[model samples]
Target: MANQEPRVLIAYGSKYGSTKEIAVHIGEVLNKAGCATTVCPAGEAATDLSAYDAAVLGGGLYAGRWHRDAVRLAHRARRSLRKRPVWLFSSGPLDPSASEREIPPVRGVRRIADRLDAEGHITFGGRLDESARGRIARMIVKSGKGGDFRDFGQITGWAQTIARDVAARTGASRGT
Candidate 1:
């Protein structure tokens, strides 16, 4: 039998590209941990969920909602993904102080994740560049004391954990 390492797909949606960068970092961590990984935008990924041993979905949150593409993908693949391992993550909450608070998961996205029985869920801090944001987004960010609030260390550590978990599960399944 062939002993191929498990394949992991990191799919994400980003408004200003911060979430895309986070997905790329997660893909790198998974690759370093020995899993084959690919990172792509949720709207552009053409691979079927069944082809991957594990999947990570990340998106930017706007107005307490995850990106539309992320939500759509989750719902569309929920059944096929139920038997596989999945992780859900969001990039939002620009306030560094807000990071310490127990912010509830975004409602619509959380429902999809719950249905899939995802292995883990996380909400990381996001960035808001007023110069790059659209009119409404710019207004919102400016109104809220805008600043970049991403925590790279925390993101890296969580990604490592996901990689480890994927490796272990894939190993155990092969043994069985």
Candidate 2:
């Protein structure tokens, strides 16, 4: 793969579109770092990872559990994932705590990361708004607990690190 740009797939499972936005940002960062990236919802993600050199799987968190679609995708693509570098991320914290500290993956997410032998995992702040669906979401938003807490700077830095790691391993030149 020398001098070849790394192909990265970023798959996300989002209920209210917040997590999807984060996934897209990561894709943009990777792309700017010279990685060829594909971003898509986990449900719509391809089961085959053969076309990509690296993978990033992320999901929205609810009740301390990862989105069902993201979990299912991990299971479906476990074999392919193990053959390459994999990363995991979760977005669910309602406060700025995630931005202030390193929030570990929830239990189920940790297990999935372990199973996939992921290179890293991160938990970004979540977003809930009046437009969010579900009674609980609406309640949270109405109760004055809804807002976007994601830190794009952190997300971009993390993605850039991934890009550097991939480029180092593949011997590919990074974009200026």
Candidate maximizing lDDT: 2
For 20-135, candidate 2 gives per-residue lDDT tens digits of 99999999999899999999999998888999999999999999999999999999989999999999999999999999999989989999999999999999999998889899
lDDT of 1 by residue, 32-118 (tens): 777788898898875367778899999899888898888877877778778789999999887884367545677887788789898
Clash number by candidate, in order? 0, 0
Local error of candidate 2 at 130, Å? 1.0
Q: Candidate 1 versus the native: TM-score?
A: 0.89
- List runs of model 1 lying over 4 Å from the truth: 1-3, 172-176
lDDT of 2 at 163: 93
Alpha carbon lDDT at 168, candidate 1: 81
Identify the leading candidate in terms of TM-score.
Answer: 2
Off by over 4 Å in 2: none
lDDT of each: 0.81, 0.94
